[model samples]
Structures are given as C-alpha cells and as structure tokens.
Target: MPLGRGYLALAALATTGGLAACGREQQTYCADQNGVVVPDVRCDDGSPGYYYYTGSYGRGRRPGYRLGGGSRIASTDSNGRARAGLPSTGHVSNGHVTSGGFGSSGHGSSGG
Candidate 1:
C-alpha cells in the first residue's frame, strides 16, 4: 500500500531524529591548559586528536596547542604562541623590532 503524506512526513522526521542522535554519539576532545581551555583538535591542522566527548566538531583554534611536524602536538605559551629556539634579539617586544644604530639617533655615532 502506498504511504500517506502524513506517514511520509512522520518517516522523514524519524529519519532526521535518528541522524541527529547519531551525531550526538560522535566524539569530542577538550582540555584545559594553563587556565586556557584548549579544545580537542589542532589550531593549525584543524583535526581531531586524543580524546572524545561526543560534542566536538573538530574545528576552531585549540589554545596552548599547535600542530607541528604534521599531526604532532607542540607546546605553546600562555598567549598561544609557540616556543621556538631561534636567536633572540635584545630589542623586540610584541612583534616589533627595534635597534640602535649609527648615524641616526640615540646610542650611535653623532658624526663628531
């Protein structure tokens, strides 16, 4: 027998509900690092990693976490900045580089 429109509507609703339930069964990852909530995922790679909680879309930035060497977890500072071993300059802060040189202003040859 052919199904009635109401029956089809009910079936569709049931299917959607089932799909929603399936989604709910999905996993998520969440972690707290240094007073920062680092979601279960990678901020750079944007992939799911290590843990599940049924509520993670596996997107968005995960604070204190960085994807390095392809799918590896790297440590980050409290400001979410990665720790690197590059040579440090004596005059730089907040991404601005400053230097005292010659023939310009302070702490340089005044062309005497």
Candidate 2:
C-alpha cells in the first residue's frame, strides 16, 4: 500500500510539472520600437496593442508600406503638394531625396 501511494505522489508531481511547462508556451503580443504590436508566444492576457512605423510610412500616411516592393501612393508633401511612392517617401522637403536611387519632380512629387 505504501509503495502504491509513493508511486501516485511521484506521478502527481510529474503531471504538475508537465502542466507548468505547457503553460509557459502561451502566446503574447507587444509593441515594437515603433510601438507596433509584435506577437510572442509568451505574453499575458488583456495586453494593450502596439503599432509599427516604417522608414517610409509616417504620421497621416497610409498603411502597409512594404520595403523592396514596387508600390506607390498619392499624398501631399510638407509644401502641401501631391506625391506618390511604392512604400513611403518619408519626409521630403524641397524635393531632396537621400536614398533608394530615387529622383523627384517639382513640388516633392515622383512617379515610375
């Protein structure tokens, strides 16, 4: 009888340990550097959401600005002129571009 009880206790401890390990695998979501929400398999419930910012995408800009992807958009520049790009053009003043080998038209505008 004592041997049976000992075995039962050991089984119970093992089962509890397994359950604890399984609980550790839960998923969670949090914000990235841009405050963009990144999902992880180890977070708490009822967490607040986050948002991610792209080098091209910014405030008052459209979403889903993918990199290395040929895309375009129609938006106004700092001078309140219309513009477009595949991902985002970031903030361009006086039609000056820094990278991506991109050129600009008058009024901070661009096209393919």
State the local distance difference test value for candidate 2.
Answer: 0.29
Per-candidate Cα lDDT values, in order, are 0.28, 0.29
- Distance from true position, residue 45, model 2, in Å? 26
TM-score of each: 0.28, 0.22
Tell me the deviation in Å of residue 31 in model 2: 11
TM-score of model 1 relative to the true fold? 0.28
Residues 29-110 of candidate 1: C-alpha lDDT, one tens digit per residue: 2233222335333322323332111122233434454322111112222111211211121211111122212211211111
lDDT of candidate 1 at residue 92, scale 0 to 100: 12
Q: In model 1, where do residues sit more than 4 Å from their true spots? A: 1-3, 24-27, 33-36, 39-54, 64-112
Worst 10 residues of 2 by lDDT: 24-33
